[model samples]
Target: MARFSYRGRNAQGQEVSGDMEAGSADLVASQLGSQQIIPLSITETETLGARSFKFDQLFAPRKVELDELIIFSRQMYSLTKAGVPIIRAMRGLQGSARSPLLADILGKVGDELESGMSLAGALQQHPKVFGAMFINMIHVGENTGRLDKAFLQLSDYLNMERETRKRIKQATRYPMLVMIAMAVALGVVNFLVIPSFSAVFAKLGADLPWPTLVLIATSNFFVNYWWAILVVLTMGAVTVWQYVQTDEGALKWDRIRLRLPLIGPIFERIALGRFARTFAMMVSAGVPMIQVLGIVSRTVGNRHIGAGIEQMRNGVERGESLLRTAANTQMFSPLVLQMLAVGEETGAIDDLFEEVADFYDQEVDYDLRRLADAIEPILIVALGVMVLILALGVFLPVWELGSVVRS
Candidate 1:
């Protein structure tokens, strides 16, 4: 497919210009005609250098952030509830959108809507901005004529996800800053402080203790081979990044992340909560159970957990009970499994899933609140050990030299 830029006149004789992906210029014109737009020009967008990397784009705002999506969903809920036409609402939103990319996409979606495409179909064109779950929910809303409710549900879900992320960042910020400060201090001491001390110790020409000797040797190594160290670190990072891009590597790494010390269980609960929340939302929206599992799996944020959800989806497709499949994964706590069983029996699984999500969220919130307190003692021990090592390495030599001079 090729992208074509076009300028046209709408039914009200207003100028409308946008880009669309089409097989040819004729197709683009046909699309405009269906929208009651008279095409003035249709030119294929240049693709010769499109594949090449542009340095400026590195710093560009290419993504629509969560805050923007949340705001959009809320505004959409209000507009739709007020009986605003979808095309006009989208055009109005385009003008008010903070992100230029989102504004442009909204304009294109409006164009698509004007061409008689369904709202969900119009949104499906921008996969990068509108996820599968988003499109599916919108499609369900369009069919059920409950678009406002759909947007409201999405707004609530996104808000919850955002809050969870904020809490996680808050919990980890202190530890992250401490670790970074420690790394910077270690570098300065190794390359700067230790060398100056080593020079004085060499001038004393006294027998150096092993601690001082080790410090001096380490400083020399860092100073002399800093470039090699940088190169090796960069290469390792690149290798790991590339590896994580592959399906198997990504799954393995995600699994390993959930096994990480200190924050592992927190991450696990977060993922499970997301899964349950998303599952509940989809099911409540009247999506099929199998499709709900499929969508929830992709949105779960952890590939290992996603894979387990995929297994549940497969089990359900094969006629197995939801509780049985969930139990088989062994990823859920007994309480959660019991909740699933009750939900299955009562046939109010959507409500039970919401409860399950709440249960996980409460656990996650408690953990995040105490995370820093739990980590502080360990960080203090580490910092103290590093200070003790440095003090002994630098000062023990000075004390020995003083004793020798007195003797």
Candidate 2:
């Protein structure tokens, strides 16, 4: 018998780890399952030792991408819709998941299921992997006997979210590339070209223009202290990343994100679209309006929008109309408000929310389609201005030197 190391959560959702004598890692996982432990990982002792020898492996985090979740959801939907037992479907998924992180999660969920935990309960053990909205929908589906439908809905939402995010990233790509190129060009001029020019001016023994003097000093600092500059920039970025993970800092930044130039409206539309779609889907699935609103509030990417949703939830709790609560927040445009009012009057609120989501989707698509057109002109103008500044700053002194030599 070979010894294998296993890490898992017990029935109480607490982590448990140990080594067991087994024929294989799979056998170890089975033993853990029989012991009511949800196996997270089961590896041969030799493999464990080898992993420990790699120092970088000890510190590296497991990353689960959105695309992986999208694929997993679709797979789950197909399996469940085909009438396969949830356990069998989970086991199949665990074996076939492309992402190691996702495979590990599915394996643990399977272990929990083997130990008689409800699917939602098993998923709840890893809140970060399955968000509150996801778990809630699953719970609703399990209770409603529509697990297949829930996964199908989740797949659609995730696909839409992914596409929307892809569009935003694509829209920003050109500008990001332009900025990086500009930085590289500036660095080249400062490090290579500027020093050569300064050396020539020094040999000429002529007093330089103020712009040339400024450029020379800037180049010298960069040449001497590039490491310090790099360190400062890295520290600043790390600090911002850490701060943005905090609730208050995240809220502040999310609010600022909505107010940013050029992309602010796009962000607003995306947030509203997410809110509307989630609300519509959950409400249509027989989830209580209050719970639906609460879930939607927490999942919206923008904290400002989330806060508005929470406020609307609270207002609804106080016996106010959904339309009134939504309108009072001043979050929705007049057209959306009108639609909500009509939906309320007609008792077709879910359908109206769906329409609202669709409207925002189209609006966002239209804006994104023209984003390059809007940004390209600005980029070109900015690039021209930068070239003009560099020309005036660098060439004026060279012209002065030429006039002196001629005289």
Candidate 3:
């Protein structure tokens, strides 16, 4: 949809102007009319020039952080529960918001609210900050008059996500630090230490072993063509980054991420857990089955897994039972499948989905606890091999020289 700037007079004869996304100027006018505003003009907002980079944005935070979203949800829940008017609550939040971006967004949302847009509709304007699932839940809540409950659910879900992310980062930090140290060591040896040893060995004029020859050759290449190597590495990184930004590449990369060694299972469990939690929440909130599937599919985080959920939605639309459709996806473990079956039979799918989420969370926790232990041995072996190679390459030459001098 294109964004249009509109000017109008509201019910109290107050003049207002704001930007809104819609298909056409007529649609924008129609929306304003619904809000009891007589539209003076609606014009499509001009797009920014492609080459016009905003330097200030480099240091400014444009995107809302997860922590900010969680706080917003929590505060909104409290305010709504206290029966505060939605517009006043939004204005209060906007004034008190720590993030300038979030405050600006809330201000726009408040304006939209004053213009008679639903809460969900106003929030939908910022897709980057509020995801499809979030907007849908609010939409459902508005329809069902349970907006407070929706915010409560969102806060819970965001907290769970935040906890999972923290655990993953904690578990992987050691391995990441070790790998970085190894890389730095490798660079230092090649660029500084090995060159000195190579010069000494060249002066000795003794027959060098293959290990020393390999080390000298590697060091020489690093010393000679470092710029070329750096350029190649930079280009490769840039290429990969660009590729992953594309739809096909992102899908492929996400699939590959699920199969990565040592951490693949962790990624899978996290994605599946997110899906289960969202599914359970939507179902318990009385969202339609079809709509729940659609929302959960997009919000699952892994594109490959999301495609599977999309297929399940299609199968259900084709008149297949939820159990049958889910089984056909082949994404769930037998235990989860069994739970789903029982839930389907007992008409308690939401409760069963909750159980599934808990099961995955437990599995994720257990795997995370073991993740450090599992990766440590591999890192140790790698460090050992590097040390052994350097030892053999350097010491063997010294041993030969000593023998010759003694003889």
* Index of the highest-lDDT prediction: 3
Of 2 and 3, the candidate ahead on lDDT is 3
What RMSD, rounded to one decimal, does every model reach? 5.2, 6.8, 3.4
Clash pairs for candidate 1: none
Model 1 residue runs over 4 Å out of place are 1-59
Error in Å for residue 191 of model 2: 1.0
| Tens digit per residue, CA lDDT, model 2, 1-407 | 66666678888887866555555778777756765788888877664233345776576457778888888888889989899999999999999988767887888888767765678867876667899789988999999999999999998999999999899889889989998999999999999998999999999987788888888999999999999999999999999999999999999999999998888899999999999999998998999888888999999888999999999999999999999999889889999999999999998989999999999999999999889889999999989987986787789998999988998
- Candidates in order have lDDT scores of 0.90, 0.87, 0.92
* Ranked by TM-score, top first: 3, 1, 2
Could you tell me the lDDT of residue 395 within candidate 2?
Answer: 97
Tens digit of lDDT per residue, candidate 3, span 334-391?
Answer: 9999999999999999999999999999999999999999999999999999999999
Off by over 4 Å in 3: 1-3, 7-17, 21-42, 50-56
Off by over 4 Å in 2: 1-61
Candidate 1 — what's its lDDT? 0.90
Per-model TM values vs. the true structure = 0.89, 0.85, 0.92
Q: Which ten residues in a row have the lowest lDDT in candidate 3?
A: 45-54
- Order of candidate numbers by lDDT, starting with the best: 3, 1, 2
By summed lDDT, the worst window of 10 consecutive residues in model 2 runs over: 45-54
